[model samples]
Target: MPELTTRIGDLTMRSPVMLASGTVGYGPEYEGVIDFGATGAIVTKTITVEPREGNAPPRLVETPGGLLNAIGLENVGLERFLAEKLPEAAPLPVPIVASVAGTGAGQFAQLAAAVGERDEVAAIELNISCPNVERPRNPVWSDPVAVGEIVSAAREATGKTLSLKLSPNTSDILSVAEAAERAGADALTVANTLPGMRIDIERRRPALGNVTGGLSGRALMPVNLALVWKVAEHVSIPVIGSGGIGDTGDALEFLAAGAVAVQVGTALFATPEAPSEIADGLRNYMEENGFASIDELVGMAREERRTCAETA
Candidate 1:
């Protein structure tokens, strides 16, 4: 059997299929519905320093190929997460990756430190660039300087593995990835949801409460794969490909493009069992292909391109 286990920084994941933040609702929501053992890790919803009620109603709308959500990082505050949610998540079989977002670098540092203090958390994923909020704050990942500062602060606050989630809305993703790398990020979640919106013609208003929201689903697979390929070429740290992974094939595309792991997000809304099914499919595909480990598949596409170029 192929070795499905992989490492991101110091944390070892049994599989490379993680449930993306905000999709799984703190790891325990799908307990009996899905097998937790099959997933690499469960990243909790992005938590904030204070409880946010999130935006007004109509926060989500279904689009042609994806979902547009403006949830606004609504979650139980840090205190509630630590006191209530963490305990519930601690008993799960897979590792817990706490996802956090904050208004500023200082708040981000505080959130990271608080989450890191928990023995159950295996890693921290920094949500530095959510696009659905109504606030006028600048995204930390959009500027290399801000990326470095925020990542540095979080790095200092957490001893656990740190994974920085970058925004697709940024002009130069490579520069932001490099900034995160230089600031001591252990891993990079190549890209987040793209900014998008829809209007209700009948109501004469925006489809989402926040007016615009982040888009995620099948449409983002190619975009996310390109990002993974590009970031993998420049950064030495592991890259966790995210955005639109929906099945084994989608996940394999990311692996072939050079992501060490992949996160399944929008798919879970439709099929709760998607993650485990993809993991099983991966194992079967690896064995059938005579690959002894998942690592062999990582960056295979890049190698093929290099070989073709050399021949030419």
Candidate 2:
């Protein structure tokens, strides 16, 4: 059998297969179907300083190739998560990454510090895409300066990996990525759901109760892959490609785009075992291709395309 181990900074994932934040809920939802230990890691939904009730009814709308959701970072909040959720989920066999978001810099840093103290947490992923109630005009993540300051501040609180999850809606993703990299981020989960809204023509209202929602699934594939490829080209740290990753080949595409690993998102709604299935497929692919490891597939397409062009 070929090696499937993947290195994401100092952490080595058994395979580059991980569950994306939000999609997999609080990690216990997949109990009967998925063997939790099979995945390299599991990133829970984005946690906040306080528990969120989330948006009102009609929060989900099924599109042709994707899902629209305005979950509004609903969770048990930091204290509750630490006290209740983590204790239950921590006993699982694999590494646990607590996905977190804060109302501001201080709030984020404090939350990171608290989670950092936990031996069960392998990392804290700062969600930068969340809309800011304070600054409704400007996106907090669009500016690299803020990204730098936030990640740096969080570093002071915890040493467990510091990762910033960047949005795909930015004007220059490379700039945002560069900012995070320069800010000393250990890893980056590229391309959170783009800010989107779908109209409910029949009801003469918005599809989601929040009016606007995050779009995931096949619709996000192309745009998200572009972000991953660009960030992988520009940033030095590990990149976790996400958004619309449904199958093993789609996961492979992200690796080809320069990601160290790929997170399976929307696929969870239908298939809980998708992550493990992709892992097995990747191992098979590596063996058939005569590659020594799954990591070898990272950016392989870049080199192959270049060679093809050169030969032409």
Candidate 3:
């Protein structure tokens, strides 16, 4: 197989296709189905300072073309993860990226330090877009300054590859992307989930136990691609494209939109083996198209779209 070689910041990955966080759990969750080694890397679920029991029952609801999840950032916390999950994932064939979320900058840093202290962790995927931000206003990822603060703190605490997972539901994603880059983030994961509410009109109440949930799947592809394209074009750092990516074609779209690499999410719920299959399909597509590196596709559609717009 010709290598779909790509780089996320300074770190080079075997392929441009990878698994997104939250959906993949701890990577071991799908051990029964697909081969973990075949993936570019496994991004672990978001871990906080303490264990999160997650949202109440009926946490997931499938929409017309997507699903809404009110998982409430459920995680085993960083300490336990280091003592328990890290040891198990440490020996995996592919790189194990430890993901962490926080209520404030300090907690993100604390989690980063806790996980970074471990030699087993290959990299850090900071979950900045998680919407469990409680109180009057406490979204660490929403504000660009807050995002920068978290990234700087995480960077200070670890020498591992630093990636900040962003939320697409923002006024200016480019500003946030630039903020993360200025704060020393090595890479940016474009988009976490769009904030959407699902109400059970029959019951005259909210569908999810938490009332609101994070949106993912095919419905989000266009929005996600837009964010990735904008952020990638706005910044020099590598961007990891995600959201609504279920097949090889979707992954290719993200690549052409300026994403150095792409991540598969939500799709894992139905097709556990989608990652490997998509990876294989991408390899075949690239080979058939006479492409050498995945980087060849970045900003491709943008130029054509711009030219068409000018003529119009």
58-108 per-residue lDDT for model 2 (tens digits): 778888899888787778998899999998887787888888888667887
Q: Where does model 3 exceed 4 Å of error?
A: 133-135, 304-312
Give TM per candidate.
0.96, 0.95, 0.93
lDDT of 1: 0.90
Model 1 stretches astray by more than 4 angstroms: 135-138, 304-312
Candidate 1 similarity to native, TM-score: 0.96
Off by more than 4 A, model 2: 131-135, 304-312
What's the lDDT for all of these models? 0.90, 0.84, 0.83
Tens-place lDDT per residue, model 3, 19-77, is: 88988788776776766766888889888889989888778888889998889888898
Highest-lDDT candidate:
1
lDDT of 3: 0.83
TM-score-best of 1 and 3 = 1
Candidate 1 residue 180 C-alpha distance from true site, Å: 0.5
Q: Measured by TM-score, how close is model 2 to the native structure?
A: 0.95
